[model samples]
Target: MNGVITPADTLGTRLTGLRGFYRAGYRSVLAYRADLLFGVIGFVIQTVLAVAVWRVLYDGHDEVAGVASSTAVAYAVLAGCIQSVVMPWQFSSLPQRVFRGQIGVDMMRPRSLISQNLAQAAGTMVGRLPIGVAGLAVGLALGGVQAPRSLLDLFASAVSILLGIANIMTINLLVSMIAFWTLETGGVMILYRFASAFLSGALIPLWFMPEWLQPIIGRLPFQAQIYAPLSIWFGTRHGGELIGTLALQLGWVLALFVLLQLVWRRAVHRVVVLGG
Candidate 1:
């Protein structure tokens, strides 16, 4: 049973397993209604602060760092909305899963362990989507997200948003596998998030940064994950540039998954996270 499993066999088994795992993750998140409520509350508070920041900057300059007033507000609203689309509920959750021995159990599966976890993590995203959608609608209505003038633009926006999520989920699975070697999950999570927020245009739009910072920021993959897509919707980057942005996102998704396979193999061979 061990050697050279066929691709067809591998796929069929994985699909069945993932379906169950995904549902379980959904149920698990829903069971903790308090957490979802608190998350919503926090998001609301953050949205208000973000809107205030953008408004002040826009008022001062007519354009905040060369970005239109409407675009800046949309950025803030999208940042809030995008928060729920990402995977890895909390950075520490991965280490906690390992410390409790879930990693070992996950490793025992016939399918790619990363896919299994990702599918489950996706469920959590789906669970949060409804409330997050409603919240984003409310925030945008109050804060003013620029509406797409055309159906094509709207469709593109939706595609970019989902692909952005896919790109994020891929990166976090790679990050989570770090629980295999070091107990410093907090540090890894913090660094990953900080880099993403700042460079990815969530914390501040790249337009707001000095010219010197813009080049440095553009080179990083972080920008491609979220801001690049959002930029397309904002019409800051259009057509081929937008297509290229999505290509980069897909590229990252593939590259990160391959890199994660290597890490998972090594961690499975060496690390011993008891019970998790």
Candidate 2:
């Protein structure tokens, strides 16, 4: 009995522990219900403003940069919802935890620091699910959003959205880990937000960008976050294109995972030597 492990004692135990972390993360967000409400309101307002601006810009034009007015509006609305799920602020406390001498306590936990941070982020996203749903509903009611053209489109869009969340989380974790090298990560955070928003199509669909810029943006992981998902939902990407986009997202997730592992190892070493 001491040497042999049953199924329940291995996989089951790990699952239970992960679930506990998730629930804790979920409750943490719920503890700030007022902030959640305000966040939803602000997102809705931004979506509405974007829709209005795009509609006016496309008033007499059939298409702008190969994208129809309807498609652009749909992209804008859905992009807003997707952005809500990929929140970077969920892990903003990592640097603070490091600075406040709490990392030592966290390191003592049985679970890996990355796993705990990920569980918290996942829980935060789950807690913010209502906000995303509300934003989608408002988008649909506003009469600009288009339904998924086909079943494949819907499925691919869903998959891309999930992958996008994972990609965003890994990126945030990588950024937070920079705290290990430098205590001041404000500049890094600010730059990441600006670059991600612009490059990810949260601010503008990549399709509308200049032809020269398209190729450059396509190579970045940012487009896979909001642009690819919205593009699928709007029925712009079909068959091979849809599959390729998802594959790209998968690649980014894998790459970022490896990066996180390498960075985390070095970070732990630094913490140990510094006695913080």
Q: Which candidate is the best by lDDT?
A: 2
lDDT of 2 at 260: 94
- Tens-place lDDT digits, model 1, residues 1-276: 578799998778778878987897688778989978787777777777777777876785666456778788877787767765463346324577676766666666776677777787888788777556765877766856777766666777678777777777777777877877776687778888887778878777777788988988876667766677677777765678767767777777677778877887777676543433
Candidate lDDT values, in order: 0.72, 0.85
Query: After superposing candidate 2, which stretches have Cα over 4 Å from the reference?
Result: 1-3, 6-9, 88-90
Candidate 2's displacement at residue 9, Å, is 4.1
Measured against the true structure, the TM-scores of the candidates, in listed sequence, are: 0.86, 0.94
lDDT for predicted candidate 1 compared with the true structure: 0.72
Residue 80, model 1: lDDT of 65
Cα TM-score of candidate 2: 0.94
Which pairs of residues clash in candidate 2, taking residues 3 or more apart in a chain or in different chains?
none
